[model samples]
Target: MLETLELLKISTREQDRVEREFNMGGAQSADKGHGYHVLRVQENSPAHLAGIEPFFDYIVGINGIPLDTPESRVLQDQLLANMDKEVVLAIYSTKEQELREVPMIPNRSWTSNPGDGLIGLSIRFCTYEATNEHVWHILNVAPESPAELAGLIPYTDYIIGTPHVTLHSENDFYEFIEAYTGHPLRLYVYNSDFDACREVVITPNHAWGGEGALGCGVGYGYLHRIPKTNKYHNSQLTYQGDLKQQPQQFNDQSLPVEKSHPSMTNTDVVTVIPTTITTAPLIIETPAEPPETNRPQQSQQYPNYHQTIHFNNDKVPLDP
Candidate 1:
């Protein structure tokens, strides 16, 4: 507490209003090839009542911020640990293509549930193209208020990207989220693109801002009832991504490397070995005067010139 307060005093940005959100990439996950870890489920959360489950990956962007490092994990954890926190979690489940968001503090307060603080349904992605290969199907319908009272199915795909549950159409984006009029919901995903899926629920804990609907949850994340591989972005969506490396130490790296090229090796071949048999390298140091030095450098391959001119006395008899 004292440490945080002391740091807050010296911080350039206001500590209280500093924007905080969900975590994504980290060394822990990266080294393990798991990427960043998110708050899948808190012990107690409002998301539980609405059928939101834990272990689902956070998929959406928060506070217009995108993170590619696990340091983001520390930052997110810090925010939740603070009092009266607000964040937006993009929830992804194995079930659907659409999205659901569990916001710490929405611009609009859309809830009136005494126990349930969220006035909106927490879901996965909400947008899609008919051209998409697969879709998440809503599965079960729990008997209760709102959506259950209305004629909706647990087998249909929840619209992507909003709290409102509306029919698919060729219209504006916001026009789609206008479906849910603020109610808790449970959706079963029918993923056409993916192979298999398991059913899970998300429950939002409002400990940080846990004043019911009046307060958002503490550790907010992308609340995907049905986790997905992609975001509701304008591009191809997939969980596969680049590695998140920790910031390299500048001075540490700025200094010269303690080693040389990996290809180069410390070998005795490179080193000049001292030998007592130097004998001038079996080489005549400086040639005497010109011609005296211009002797046959390399010996003839076959033999000396004398060998080719065989002048035998016996051969002379035949030449007569």
Candidate 2:
């Protein structure tokens, strides 16, 4: 217990040196420099399920003491070098505020706070593209998705739609991803060949975790697919004189040169379509009053800070 207290005292001093008040981002500073802070506590992360997020402004000291910063990197470094392997965090647990010392034993993956009652949400490594074909084979929007919720559907390739969806580039597919963050969109899709078409709205929800957070859809890689579309031909070709260009034929039928891409995707996506809530939904472009700019801070002193220490914990002193 004495040794643990000493470590805590040292860690607290380090945290104090780094954590500065008045940051631009939301809360999550306590376990700042320690390795534990990397495992974010978003409602979805394992840490969050373990009842982490217990307090805010984890700034225990300044330059080897407690404090936050005014949006600068120097101060950030000062706060991070003080952590090691014993800080614990979560939403709720036996110990309320302050971290409960945890040994730096690898694979100590046990949390008292049950866990995120498993679900079937599929996760994958992927990216999305924008193509006319993607928009051409149109259909209705998927309800409860970002697209549909945005009040737009993959209908008649609206080269122009509200919410101002734009093509970021012919190469970077994640271009429109920014459009989905904090905003939802509804989509309508279709495929002439399959004689299948439907509306399914999709939204991109991402969060970063482990001490500090990044965004949703963890364990993925650099996604780079162009967001493109294909030309929507109303009528299929009858006896074609030049359809030979399409070297590939299905069921002995000449096919069109397949040269179109798709849009916003949920990769390796494992999902269970929810029951279509009241068919008619509302889409607010600019509500009379926009939603709160930032979420509410749970704690008092210097709240509104979210976790973010993108380094491996090694700065703290070794116990003798």
Candidate 3:
């Protein structure tokens, strides 16, 4: 999880700035006893600009109306009620480990229908459980593209949001681009290699002479999926494609040329097909000894002329 803390301020002086398609300073709440805990903060939204982070901040008060009632839905109700007015929030941050006041104003120009909250925040009926429901994996980024200019790394970064829009799949990202064409897209992404999340802004435009609006290819993946460390092996291992992890030593004879790349992505790496492998064993041998030969010779005589004979070999006779 990201451990950074920031305080953001957004201006709603003009009514036009207050309204957009996905216009609620991108903040939602979950039940928190008398108060409500922040669950999601849209990227570049008013909530995000005000430094409101989901799961790490709790909303204890709103517009000076202390959300201390037993009714858990009170805060969401009150915020939705004052959709077009200045709303101040009392927030507690786990990163800062303190309480602070944040100001947010709803700028929606369109009147919300009955039971409709258009401030970009989705109210959660249950406890907020962190999961990888939204993914923004950049499969390929074109040169001189907005994504490239924004420093979006391909195959390593996960896109989480576009200002107030939370992207979970490629279709969501596509729809958001089509709906908000030519809008300055502020993106919040989880970098797998860094194990950290970061924010980047890319203005979607077709004048860049690219195929797509952003000139980038993206796919869906789990947010929690991180790249594994590298390992090196002596004699048995060889350098292949990009090496993102550390190196280790091993005795394996060969690695699959296609499947043994260094980087481990969330998509295809998991479904890699195994390749054939072979092993080599060690062996030893010894030369056989020549056939034994014997030569007899008399050495000395004792008591009645005795003769001594010996065999010429490394081994001695049992009798000797």
Candidate 4:
């Protein structure tokens, strides 16, 4: 078994080529370098049964062997040769930021499709970056849409990830939103204008009379990365401090006003204050209230329309 697996090993030159092609920054430790990113894991398959999660997991090694090869055929060949035999896969979780070993026996009977691999997983060779730099840039959010209602700001906000799941690919965010359709999915969003991270809850639904579930256009890749400037860094800290103090100030003001009005019962006064304060941030940050004369003419053209917008040769459907 050991000799058969040795065939999967590539030359040192080939390994270097792999690193260069994927921009993995040369040789890295066994646990933190290049690996095959799991894009999809078929249900009831060996990979899924072994707790391999799609989009957030990477297959780094097979049978204690690090898969540093450029081509995915190396990993496929190893699995095919080790069929029916218990093989240990070195799995890396992007969410947990850890490496673990999962044992599974590959077989063709897992799925009805004849073309399905023994492991039943779709993966692509890529470099793994242990950073929260990746983000989905919000482009246009439809008026009265779920995204707008949830406080997502177009061209200003970026969806980083959720509390539990760390988004690895562009499709990860879309898939997550679909999974939580009709249910609230809390996301950690960063604003370019504020340079701050905050939690936003969005309930995605198809009944919102929009083309997409969230009614928002999100762009990924290098162009959408967060700006690396300290221009707003100092202000972000000051803004966060102000946010904490605002609630206390509102509470103090509301209590005295409630005492002044004895006719307006305690329950009515208490409910009004909480609702007003909770939505205060959204009201203040809303971009719709700006005068059209002050804004650009092109932005006003698609005020209530949803259409495709091309960006760098890629077609992105944007809602306004």
lDDT by candidate, in order shown: 0.24, 0.22, 0.39, 0.49
Off by over 4 Å in 3: 1-130, 166-170, 222-320
2 or 3, greater by TM-score = 3
* Ranked candidates, highest lDDT first: 4, 3, 1, 2
Score candidate 2 by lDDT.
0.22
Give the distance in Å from residue 268's predicted Cα in candidate 4 to where it truly belongs.
65
Best by TM-score: 4
How well does candidate 1 match the true structure in TM-score terms?
A: 0.22
Query: What TM-score, to 2 decimals, does candidate 4 have?
Result: 0.40
Please provide, for model 2 over 14-82, each residue's C-alpha lDDT reduced to its tens digit, 9 standing for 90 to 100: 333322311112243122221111111223322233222211112122222212222223212321332
Question: Model 4, range 143-197, lDDT digits (tens) per residue?
Answer: 9899999999998887655533444443444544544567776665767676445
* Model 3 error, position 75 (Å): 14
Q: What are the TM-scores, per candidate, against the unseen true structure?
A: 0.22, 0.19, 0.34, 0.40
RMSD of each: 35.6, 27.4, 34.2, 21.5
| TM-score-superior candidate, 3 or 4 | 4
Off by over 4 Å in 1: 1-43, 46-51, 74-78, 105-320
Model 2 per-residue lDDT at 10? 36
Candidate 3 Cα lDDT to native: 0.39
User: Which lDDT tens digits does candidate 1 get at residues 99-182?
Assistant: 334344321123333212221121122121221222223344444423334433454333222111222332221121122113
